[model samples]
Target: MGASLNEIKSKIASTAKTSQITGAMQMVSAAKLQKSENHAKKYQTYASKVKQVTLDLVSHDKGPSKNPMMLKREVKKTGYLVITSDRGLVGGYNANILKSVMSELMKKKNDDAFSVMALGGMGADFFKARDIKVSYELRGLSDQPNFEEVRHIVSEAVKLYQSEEFDELFVCYNHHVNSLTSEVRMEKMLPISFDDVTSTPSLDTFELEPDRDQILDQLLPQYAESLIYGSIVDAKTAEHAAGMTAMQTATDNANSVIHDLTIQFNRARQAAITQEITEIVAGAAAL
Candidate 1:
């Protein structure tokens, strides 16, 4: 009985440690999420404005020239920029994004050859294990990422596009819909489409200096950079939210286990005491 009690005590101690770790992790994730949430919101506003302005330029300009990125090409090759967390314990955050990408890949035509640009450690590993060629990789990014942090990957991806390494490009990441919810999004990157702008009844009028082609030549790259960076910011925010939720659940489960173990321990201790009292009373009676 004593040995069993000691074992339970050890288990309780270990579980308490685990609970503390999880609680601390939850707090950390919450703090990160707070910072990232603000960034994500601001980035979304910036991204929308950039898109609107670019669409306005593309729609109003009556030029004989067009940006190459705006032109559609044959889909012989594809580039996938997959964003995931560098660390685990974020519940299904990474898994959900990966699954979404994989599902899309499975639907592609047999002749399409795709390459991946892995933005985090988990994503790189996931693709590598499946024999998917990762042509570019950037990992160990901060939870609150800035545009410069991902500039190199963006540049290289653009270069790949220019070189015709891939006819089309797509970015896959988790979008932070709310604190409790996120949606996996696969966005087309290359050959920027102005369909939404063209369909809209309203368009912004822009006065271009030194011709529209030169201005557009510079604007298109900035627009692409903003899109990629914005997606990364959104994904980071989602990752933090997911981590906080996962850690909170883990902490709750740990508390429940501790409570159950404490109850069993108490019952065992009470039974042992009752047995000891019975034996002592019987000995006195015998004497």
Candidate 2:
């Protein structure tokens, strides 16, 4: 019993150390979550402004004028852009979003309706393992992503859309509402919707130095990139928030485990001491 008590004490100590590590990680993730959340909100504003400007310029009643992204093509194939975290340990953060996207795909008319361009390893591997077609895969992005890193992927997706290769495009990601809550969101990227238009004041309404039509031809693609970039930022915010919460829960669980183990250790030690006293008293009585 003495030996068992010591062993259990050692386990408790090890668990305590692990809990400390997780606690530190929780703090770090909390700080990151704050920054990411702010950035996501700011980017959304910029994206919204861009969308509104584009919509106002292209607000013709007839429809979009020869815009590839706005054109509705026959569905030869579709693309799913799965945005998930590269690493795990964020509770149901990745799983919930992935499952939502998979369930959505399962409901599509064609059994194998879409290919994926995965932004993270988990979703990439998930699609590959399932023999779902994958057009591209990019991973190892930082906690706070900059738009430059993912330009290649965005360009490729845009090119594919322009070439009439993919009739539709979707980005499946988790949107950060707050630290404690997030929602798995699916955004349609191609065949741009009227709702994409926003109400922003900063976009110059009277600046006609470069002519709206020519400027729009160039601005539309950049605006599309902004949407992708904004989504990535939003997804990252959710990831950090989820990670912080998960780590805090892990720390709490570890502390609870240590509490139980310490109680067991104390009982074992007391039992061992009692046994020693009992043996000595018995020996004296026997003498």
Q: Each model's number of backbone clashes?
A: 0, 0
Clashing pairs in 2: none
**RMSD for each of the candidates:** 2.1, 2.5
Tens digits of lDDT, candidate 1, 88-157: 9999999999998888778777534788899999999998898877888999999898888899999888
Task: Please give the RMSD of candidate 2 to the true structure.
Answer: 2.5
TM-score of candidate 2 against the unseen true structure? 0.91
TM-score of every prediction relative to native? 0.94, 0.91
**All candidates' lDDT scores?**
0.87, 0.84
Best by lDDT: 1
